[model samples]
Target: MEWTQILTLAAKEFRDRMRNRWVLAVALVFTVFSLVIAYFGGAQQGAVGFRSIEFTIASLVSLVIYLIPLIALLLGFDAIVGERERGSLDLLLSLPITRLELLLGKYLGLAAALTLSTLAGFGLVALLLWQRIDTAGLYHYAGFMLSSVLLGLAFLSLAVLVSVVARDRTRASGLAIALWFFFVLVFDLLLLGVLVGTGGRFGGEAFAWLLLLSPADVFRLLNVFSLDDVRTLYGLASIVPTSLGSPGVMGGVMLAWIALPLVVARWRFK
Candidate 1:
């Protein structure tokens, strides 16, 4: 738990990603996609240009949900396993660093890279739209960016856990993609299908609790509930309970998603 050693390892991880151009590639992806969505997302409605921050954020939420988790998984799914395959894991373990410090260092470094890219990508768009948005709109956009970072960190934690448990990088990657698919695509559909088939008998108040299981959903609720226009646009006004919609609640849930996986990964790595 020595801060100096942890920070040194974290700096090394960050530098490795930089040397590999991982940061540049991800930052470019974020910037391009965000700019496109901000300007052209409303084209179907015969609208084009920098629309309201609400609409931009709403569109960005969908993009972040799909993109961030995949990037995080790709970035971290092989963190441990790849090292092991390269014969570096044992060498690193032989150093003066404790396992907890090593794990935390790696996580911090990856999280920093993700956060920097996310902010750079989305922050550029926010700058472009700065003059177009009001104070409230700016606040909403900022909140969206923060939550997007949280979502990435959550998935990265999962990837770390996958890396810890998998026998090799191939299996780690497969598990990471499966994790993304389950949380992003399949989980909600299955929940809805169950609710429909059972006619609300199976999932009553518990339905909302179920949404917390998926970090993406928690991120969605955090953003969607913040803006009135976006809330109604998503048709979540009636379905989402007031208590569960609180920023405090959703933020806590997102933090839990980030922490729980890292805890498990720490245990497994040990």
Candidate 2:
């Protein structure tokens, strides 16, 4: 409830991550991967150069979907459990800080660290490609970066929830990895499997709505539908309905993904 308590805890958490060089490492990884994708993504096709912004973004979207969630899960999977494992949770709670303050502070601090690293990593690539991309391209790229941040925040929320619910750090981590695998890898395959097994008789509008259930898919749709070329490339034009494809609607869904987990964590933490 108190902003001062929350901010103080957040500052400590942020400083801890910075001192350990986690942010820099993540940023570097993003920068390297992004630069390579931007410049050399066409190497397999016998051409090697910076491609169009749409193609670059489309490639990066796949990268972010796979990478960001894993990073975020690892970052926050132990947030609360680690403190408890070290016997610091009780001591921290004994201070003036309330439970809500601690939870919010931890989430905010981790979210800040992830946001900075993602922006710095991808923003550098943006700067490098600035001359080649026009204003509209720049706009789309910025949207991609923002949506990537939301995706990270959403997964970090899930990590925090796992931390709150699990009995120990090991369990929390296992849950986090299971979550990453489910949302990033298995969720889509299962959906498609059902559609195929049912021979397309089972899914129409309902199928598209199911994609909204996973933050990764929502992020995918958000970025894909925003660009005509990329959307056509993904062949999602028929699968995703117009109403669900709106950026505002998908953004709201992403926000829910970020908030709902934290709400559950807060409840369980108490």
> lDDT tens digits, residues 142-215, model 2?
99999999999999999999999998999999999999999999999999998999998887559999999999
Task: Provide TM-scores for the models.
Answer: 0.98, 0.98
* Cα error, candidate 2, residue 102 (Å): 0.5
- Expressed as tens digits, the lDDT of each residue in 199-251 for candidate 1 is 98898668888999999999999999998888999987788898888999999
Candidate 1 Cα misplacement greater than 4 A, ranges: none
Which lDDT values do the candidates have, in the order given?
Answer: 0.91, 0.95
In model 2, the worst 10-residue window by lDDT is: 198-207
Q: How close is candidate 1 to the true structure, as a TM-score?
A: 0.98
In candidate 2, the residue pairs with backbone N, CA or C atoms under 3 Å apart (3 or more residues apart, or in different chains) clash, namely: none
Our tally of clashes for model 1 stands at 0
